[model samples]
Target: MASVYKSLSKTNGSKEDGPANGVKKNKQRVLILSSRGITYRHRHLLNDLASLLPHGRKDAKLDTKSKLYQLNELAELYNCNNVFFFEARKGKDLYLWMSKAPNGPTVKMHMQNLHTMEELHFTGNCLKGSRPILSFDSKFDTEPHLRVLKELFLHIFGVPKGARKSKPFVDHVMGFTLADGKIWIRNYQINETEASKVTSADVEEGLKKKEKRDKTGGGKETEISLVEIGPRFVLTPIVIQEGSFGGPIIYENKEFVSPNQVRSEIRLKKAGRYNARAEQGIERLAKKGELGLRTSGGRAPKKDELDTAELFA
Candidate 1:
C-alpha cells in the first residue's frame, strides 16, 4: 500500500504543464557574438539585433575565425539553442552565420547594405523586447532551401512566449522578402488609432449613434497601420553547411561572386588602362626616333626653319 502511494505521488510529480506525447515547448535562447575584426557598422548592427532579442545572450568578440565549431561549445555553455554569429573579413565584408547549435544545417550568408536603427532615423518606434510578428514573402515556401532559410529565421528571430525580458505587447513586425536571389529584412511598428469615418449614410441616420455615444462614450474602434522601423539589411546566401559551422556543404551559390574578386577585377582594369597608356607613349617615342624628330645619345639639336636661332638670324 505504501509502495502504491509512492508510485502515485511520483507520477503526480512528473506531470508537467506541457503538451503530451513528449513534444517540447518552443523555448529558444540564442548566443549572439561576432569575430574580432568587425567594423563599427557591423558592431552596431549586432547590437541592434541583440537589443531586439530579449532571449539572446551577447558575448565578447570571438578571438578566432578558423575553428568556428567552437561556437557550438559556447552555445552549450550559455544554454543557447541557436547561434547568431557575425564574421568580418578584410575589415569590410561581413558574413552572418545562423545555426542550430550542437546540430546540423548551418547557414552562412553575406550581409550587405546594412543600416543601423540610429542611422535610419525612422519615426517608428516600439517597446524594446516586445514580440514581433514575422511576415514572410510567399516565395519562401516555393523552394527547399528557402524553406530551410525561413526556418532558421524563425528560430533566430522569433521571440518565444514568456521570454524573460520580453514585453507583454506585440508592437512590431519583421518582414522578410526574397527578391533577386537575396533576402531583404525590414521592421515596422504597429500603430493603432481610433478610426473615425463619417459617411453620407451615417449623416442620414440623424446622429443616433453619436447621441448614444455622447450619453455613454464607451466604445472606440481603432485602425491598425504599419510604420517603418528600421535596421534594414540584405542577405545573400553563400552556402549551407551540414553541421554547426562545419561538415560538408549542402548548398552553394555558384552565382555569388566574392568582393575580393570584384575589387581585383576593377584594379586589373585600371592597370590595363595604365599599361595601354604607357605602351602608347612608348610607341609615340619610337615613331619620333624613327622619323629623326628626337635627338639621340646627346646629339646636337637639329636646326629647323622655325628654330629660334634661324628666326633671330
Candidate 2:
C-alpha cells in the first residue's frame, strides 16, 4: 500500500511537473594522462595544467599509443566524462588529444613553443584550483572547425560550478588566440589595484595607501588588471575524429604539416646542396682532363698537323 501511494505521487504530479528543483546541474570530471616517452618539459606542462583544473584526475602514463580506445575504459573507471591526453614522439614532439569520453568528436593537436611557469618567472600568481575566465579570439566563432575546438577547450579547461576542490572565487584568465592556423594559449592573473593612479610610480604608492585604508578598516574596491602567469604554448590542430579515439574523421587541416615531414624536407635540402657541390667538382675535373691540365689522369693534347714534330718526321 505504501509503494502504491509513492508511485501515484510520482506519476500524478500536476501541482509541480518538472524537476524537484528547477535547476540544471553542470557536472564534469576530466581524466588527464600522457603516453610514455614524453620529455620533462611535456610532463611539467601537464602538471601545471592538472594543478589548474580542480575537477581533473591525473593518472599514470598510458603504455600504448596505437590503441587509444583504452582511454574510454580508464575514464569510466575514474568517473570522468572528459579525457586530456598527451602523446609524445621521438622524445621531442608532443601532441595533445582532447575528447569527450565514450562518444564521438575528438581533437588532436600538435603542441609547440611550450614554456612552463617555472621557467617564465612571471610575477603573476593565483590561488591553486581557482576558477579561470576563458577568453577566446573572435575568429573562433567564424569557422566550423574552430568552433568545435573552442567547445572542447571550454569543456576541458572551464571549471564547473560547485566542483569539488575548486576555489569559490575566480582569479585568473585563460586566453585562447587563433593566429597563423594555430591556437595560442596564455594564462594571466587578475591583479586588482586602485584605479585612481595615473602613472607607474604613483601606482605603488596608491596600492600602499589603499592597503592602509583597509587595515584601518574600510576602502572601496578598485578596478582589476591582468598580469601574465604563463605556461605558454601553441597548438596546431591536425584532425578531428568523430569518435572518442576512433571513427571517421570529421575535419582535417590541409595546411598543417607534420614535424616529420618538415624534418625530412630539411634533410633533403641539405643533401641537395652536397650533391650540387659534388657535381660541380666532377665537371671541373673533366674540364681539366680535356685540357691535359691534370697531372695524374688526363687526355694528352692532340698534336697539330702543321707541328714541327710532324713535318720533321
Best by TM-score: 2
Q: Cα deviation in Å at residue 162, candidate 1?
A: 1.9
Each prediction's TM-score versus the true structure: 0.80, 0.85
Look at candidate 2 and tell me the lDDT of residue 219: 50
| lDDT at residue 98 of model 1 (Cα atoms) | 98
Clashes of 2: 1
Residue 140, model 2: Cα distance from true site in angstroms:
0.7
Whole-structure CA lDDT of model 1: 0.88
Instruction: Give the per-residue lDDT digits (tens) of candidate 2, residues 1-313.
Output: 9999988887878336446546755678999999999999999999999999999999999999999999999999999999999999999999999999999589999999999999998777899999899999999999998999999999899999778999998899999999999999999888765755444533444545555445535356665566678899999999999999999999999999999999999999999999999999999999999998887787987888999999999
Q: What is the lDDT for 248 in model 2?
A: 96
> Who wins the lDDT comparison?
2
Error in Å for residue 254 of model 2 = 0.7
